[model samples]
Structure formats: C-alpha cells, structure tokens
Target: MKRLEGRVAVVTGGASGIGFASVERLAAEGARVVITDLNEATGKAAVQRMADAGHAEAVDLVCGDVADEAHVADAMDRAIDRWGRLDIAFLNAGVGGAFGSLLETAVEDWDQTFAYLTRSVFLGIKHAGKRMGEGGSIIATASIAGLGGGAGSHGYSAAKAAVISLTRTAAMELGPRRIRVNAIAPGVISTPLAHRGKESNLEALCARQPWPDTGQPADIAAALAFLASDDARFVTGETVTVDGGLRARSSDVLGDNSMLLAGRTGMNRGSTGLKSGFRNTDR
Candidate 1:
C-alpha cells in the first residue's frame, strides 16, 4: 500500500521470528528497512533473501548486540546513512531466561534479562528518539506477563513491566515532538523461543490455550506494521495485547457436576479439576 514509502525503519533482532516478519512487512510496504541482529550470518542471509525476493535495494543488515550503546548507535547511523532519515524504530530484541522462581533465580540472570529486555529499550528510545526528532514511531515488544504476576522467569516479567513504563514515559517526553512510542504485549507466539515447548509436554500446553491453535510470529509482525505506519499516528503510550483470548478467559473450569457439587459443599479447595496453566512463551 506504500503506507511507509520513502521511510527508514530500524528493526532490532530482525534475524528471526516477529522481528524478521516485521522487517519483511515494512520492506514490502515500501520502507527502507535496516535489520539489526547479533547473528551476523543469519542477519546477512535475511537481507539477501529479501533482496532476492525483489526488495533488492530496500533492505540492509547490521550485526550488533542491542544492549550495547555503540551497536545501537551504529544501527541508527546505518539506517540514516542508507535512507537519509529515520521514521520507525522497532525495539524488538529480547531474550527469555530460564524458568525459575524469584528466590531461586540468580542475580546475574536477572541482570542479563534486564540488560537485554529493559535497558536495551532504553537505549533504543534514547537514540531512535534523538534521531527521529519528530514524526516517528517506536514500538517495544513486551509480553502479556507484564500485566500480571508471573510464575516462571520472574526477571522477564519485571523487565517487560518496566518496558511498558518506559514506553509511557518516552511517549510523554516525545509527544511534544510528534514522536509516538508504544508497546506490544504478545501472548504465546510460536517462534524459535517458544520451541522450548517441543522438549516438554506439548499436548498439555496446547490444551491450555483458549484457541485451538497457537499464535504465529506474523501475527505480531502485522500489528507492528500497523503501529509503525501512519495508521497509528495518533496512538502512543499504549500496550496492545495480541493474545488469543487466553488472558480474557476465566481461570475456573469445572470437570463435571461432581466437582461442581463438591465445590459447593467446600469438599475441595476449588482445585479438584484444575491443571497447570500455560507458561509465558513470548520472547
């Protein structure tokens, strides 16, 4: 639709999953896309694939860690150098740490999670906002866990919560300049990060989803494209949830009339037919 024609976009973690999908969508919509990833080979190959697919001059790949200031700066530099101006920044680079409770989680692990998920957002907003000045959009990839208490990987939940707050503050600060900032909280997307489920009980996980099927990276990517485009020009400081009705479902589920009757009599602790809820797999 050429909604972003002549625009320059920087998508962090663009080598795979939602980030990669967003890069492809942006390029398809006529934006000059610069994909940044820590994996040099995959990043270059992704750009090449896009080029081969007829987006030859619209894509570039930069390799660097999103948490590094110099790397983030270099990515921004590359986007501006190639396209002359920056219009969109998708700070989607993040990692999901091992599942563990807060008390059992190591301090270093917490630090690393915050570094990539939270501090990296800070760096992205700082540099991208500075370069954009006005008429730009910054979207962060948060998770639904940010909205509530988490059971596994406490650090990730906390970092995502911080990302939401960061988005709000950045929006307030940049609104005067007409630069919008927002976040997307995806539920359970089937991405490389979610592949950890294959090693576990996949059946049980599938049963827990409100929808029959799991979400795809492209779902989140499409949301990103809309947010980055002028379609969301008036949207800012918001977190749009992309869950498959999982978050809105009721937690209580009765197995049979016997269980319901038992619950009325206080015979069970409202747990006779309960099962372990699905874990947060968004990264």
Candidate 2:
C-alpha cells in the first residue's frame, strides 16, 4: 500500500513551486488532497492538470489568501468534508520578501512579510491541528536563511526564523495528540521566487552551491512526503535541512553570501500569500 493510502491532506500555495510539488507527491503516495492558493485560475488549472494525470478523484482546489484565517480553516474543512479526515497539512506558501537591509526595510513591509510567511503557518497549525486525528503530520516551509545570518534579506530571514519557532512550539502541544509538526529548510532552490524571474541566473547560482545538483521543488517534496507518511511517525518538532550540503560549509566559505546582493535596494516581495506565483508583487 502507498504510505498515505487512506490519508487526506491540505496544501497551501499549491499552484506552484514546492507547494505544487508537495501536492502531487502526497497524492502519488495515495493521499487525497485539498489545495489552496491566491490565484484562482492557476490554482484550478493545477488541480485540473492533476486530475488529468489520473488523480481526478484525489484532488480539489480552494482559491484564497493563505494569511487569512478563514481560508486556512476552510481548506482544512474541505479535506475533512471531502475525505472524512485531515491527516496532513503542508503550510508551504511563501514569497520573496522585503529584500533590503534592516534599516532600509519599512515597518509595513516587515509586518506584511510576517503576515505572509509566519502568520499563515500559525493559522494552518491552528485550524489543521484542530481537525487532525492521531498520527497526523503538519509541515511548514522554512529556509536556510532562518538557520543563520548571511542567507537572506532582513525581513525574510526574520519571518522564516519565526516559522521554525512555530513548528517546534506547535509540535509540543500537538504531540500528545499524536500529531507531528515539522519544518523543511531549503537552500538556493531553482524556483521563480529564488531566481527573481531569472531562471538561468538562479540555476547557475544554485549549481555553485556546495551541492553539485541544484535544489529542486521535488527534493523538498520528497522530504515533505517522508514527514507526512507513517515513516516519520516517530519524528516531531524538527526542521529538516533539504539544502543539500550548502549549509554544511561556513557562510563565508565562498566569500560572504550576503555580499551577493549587498547594497542592491530593490525588494523582491512576491504574491505568495496573495498568490503562489513567484512573480514580483507591487504590494
């Protein structure tokens, strides 16, 4: 039997990137999923694509902002209403965030950053944790930037650090109920958000990482499925580093990582909570 044959899942930001990949991975592993994203059209198309791929009866979509409590709750409810129970929640929606020095970052941008990255995870945990039964798995998308300095912009790094904390705290409260909470920290992934719309440039940078192969969405999806499956039943409150060995080396091993974008003032906030696409968002 597939690891998640009888499970039901909710994945936020399911229209693209790691979120979309996780939806497919979980379904392929025999789990029925309810997907949520900011863009209605793209999100529906993704569901339809999966349906065409033979998971027609195994997937559904809900279009809305991930940071909204109502949407998060609704996504969880959709899973239970459709499949009878919620076994996994992948709170993996995020955007390129306030990418500037702390002093240069605006307060509004900072709040918005947390709202999109951290608040969404909090809502997912609150709503999904309540609906989940024993042996449920809740995974959030964190980043190596949260692990230490020199890896991300000021606001983005802080927001991700908060996610890591949330994962641990949620695990403690949900553990006794047999629910596992975990986070995955990906490195310089070859994604639209990471590349800032320059796929070729991002691919080249990813290749330069300590790991020879560039990090892909599927790499993180594989890890997410592991955490979601019974195999990780014994694991909880941990952040799995999926950045290959990039974090293994010192941050300055290849010159200061921060210097790569130092002094470049353009922030790269995206429609992650607003939409899963990696396109730059003005708001």
Best by lDDT: 2
- Clash counts for the predictions, in order: 0, 0
Evaluate all candidate structures by whole-model CA lDDT and list the values in order. 0.77, 0.83
Please give the lDDT score for candidate 1.
0.77
Worst 10 residues of 2 by lDDT: 273-282
lDDT of 1 by residue, 135-234 (tens): 8999999997787753124666788999999999999999999999999998777776555446342344445568787788888988998999889989
Q: Which stretches of candidate 1 lie over 4 Å from their true place?
A: 197-203, 251-283
Off by over 4 Å in 2: 253-267, 271-283
